[model samples]
Target: MQTNNTPQNIAIIGAGASALFVSIILAKKGFHVTLFEKNPKAGKKLLATGNGKCNITNKNLSLNYFFSSNPSFIKYSIENFGYKEFLTLCEEIGLNLVTNENGKTYPASLQASSVVDVLYNEALFLGAKFSFDSKVENIDFKEKAHIISGDKTYKFDKVILATGSIAMEKLGGCSSGYELAEKFGHNIIKPSPSLVQLTSNDKEIHTLSGVKSEANVTLLVDNKPQKTLFGDLLFTNYGVSGNTILDLSREANMAILNFQKVDIVVDIFPTLDKNKLLALLEKKKKILSGKDKNSLLLSLINGKLIPFIYKKAKIDSKKYFIDNLDKKDLQALTYTLKSIKIPIDGSKGFDSAEVVAGGVNVDEVDNKTMESKKQKGLYFCGEVLDVDGACGGYNLHWAWASAFSLASNMK
Candidate 1:
């Protein structure tokens, strides 16, 4: 894998998965590698992934699943060090990965700490130097070094910037990567929070707080279906938020920012056809003609959404049975269950996104080695780049692949 057949002294600018992984691979080859992080420990964000399970990679891997300014650039890294290589690296580092029901790989111990521990320990074992509480302030391209904590400076022949984007402010993420990119003459895409929870200012969200349902959510960009996600969706006082909403958050936010009305289409019953749902409802209405709609509806749904559904359907809580049902009325109920619309007020901000979109434009960096075209002996990787993938281990996969690219190209 080391085509260069030699090691290079490398200074990794961040202690995140991207920098740690590249240091691990390069140091294992007897390269001089030093990883710098402002945090007290490495992999702070790593432990928070997958709600602590740390979804390492997904089974469904394809290039179409990612978004980038230069779409073709990610093809090289992903093709070179795809999901298989990530698993292999875990095992090589003495961490056994176990696959979940959804094909998401996790540490066998089910502890995210185990994965972070392995990466941290492996890097150390490979002779990688880690300097915690080392914040890199400005970069000096002319001197080939980074200014740390506003004053301290770390010089190197080759530098890898992987501090990540401005998402997750609570987790200590910022635009240091962007600042470094600008210092090196690289163009940065306007950063927007991605993979974060959406919060609406609408009062209807209050009615459905804590209500979750199996639904098909479609993102309507200018009332046109841009993408659709099928999964479990949960609603809160903010808005509809879940893996489903997060999947389409970028587009939804972009649309909302453009002053276009953004709406979420949730089909609570995607499997049941209109006629089937209508027939079942009709039969149920006949069976419980005397029962009030409030109680009967509770049994129909998951109980939490009965009132919300009634309000959405404009159905009277006490109305039990309509003497005669017209096709249009039946259609209205069917449509209500099949296509529920919710407005997107805004996202919870960058402090909560799993990954941020819009980074250093990918076209400025060669995916083959993650080297920046704008600067010599400088490489970029991880969330610092524009390429971002859908949820389910895709972002982690990018980190692994980009790191592998950098390590393999050492000379």
Candidate 2:
């Protein structure tokens, strides 16, 4: 695998977001690039993203938005092929975009299939060929050629290991990406499930199953608050879910593994502060004196959560007004509603996770080129690497940013 000057028939393992980028950019450079996908289709996982709407990239590209083993590794690629550049590329491929209020970019059509189709079209137009049902068994580098996918060996002057990670097993993800990296003598930084819903050990959450509310979740690691998030929280038989809970799930996973107390503080009535909430409840009691608990509570919170909230607050359903409530009762109800706590015991794992965290350590790869420090012709990109970003379009941004360098660096 010498860095010899030769026209590489670059072989990209996996037909995911990064693989498509590799194919398009390398093929455009007039290099022969073959994409191998184990699934019956390319972008199977991509098509499943954003609830099939496909959040392509975040409109903003800032360093604080992502996490990685090598914290600085993403700076170069992100700066070069940033969010704006990615949108421009999408536009070039006939996929115009719309940025949401929070800066998450989606296709104008709002269908993930539209984005996948355009990416597929771009790769095909660039002369890259895809081989489906082509599962890779092993990869070895010899004189600028990669022998991969078992006996069906591939010869490439440069090889991009954009095989992705083990997240969606039913969709063919099983650490093939990590296996490919290890075969090339690279170190993987322990893979685990992330961006998934957490199951709580507390029995209370189960009783309130099917109840969803706009709340905030704060993650505790080693009995310390690690991160906080606010959004829609869904209660389930096993545990808690939804946008807010998912953001803080990784911390819950880590803390739960260590047998630490992992809890989510849900601010059910985020719009009303503690004092204001109490005042509002007192005022409403006088206005709706004869109404039942469900009726009065429904006007304030979702009717679905009334029973559970009443149970947690130790409030009698027979009584409707705060006029009969003592100070202790008022404070308890406010605390339970404004800061309901759920214990984290387990997670939905890869199946429900949007993306997997903790992959090939960034220390072992070149940031600018994504070339493995241990292997001459090998490269890593996408979720298979150690980079994990926050919700929104940050994950897709990482994939595109990492692969953009790989595609450009290929000779």
Per-candidate count of clashing residue pairs (backbone under 3 Å): 3, 1
Off by over 4 Å in 1: 1-8, 143-150, 316-328
Model 2: residues >4 Å from true position, as ranges? Answer: 1-6, 289-296, 315-323
Every model: Cα RMSD to truth: 2.3, 2.6
* TM-score for candidate 2, residues paired by index: 0.93
**TM-score of decoy 1:** 0.94
Q: Pick the candidate with the highest TM-score.
A: 1
What is each predicted model's overall lDDT from 0 to 1? 0.80, 0.79
lDDT of 2 by residue, 311-368 (tens): 8888866665545665676677788888776667779888777777789989899898
Summarize candidate 1's per-residue lDDT along 157-248 as a digit string, tens digits: 68889887787866658888898888777888888788878877678776778988888999887788888899979998778778898889
Q: How much RMSD separates candidate 1 from the native structure?
A: 2.3
Query: Which pairs clash inside model 2?
Result: 1-143
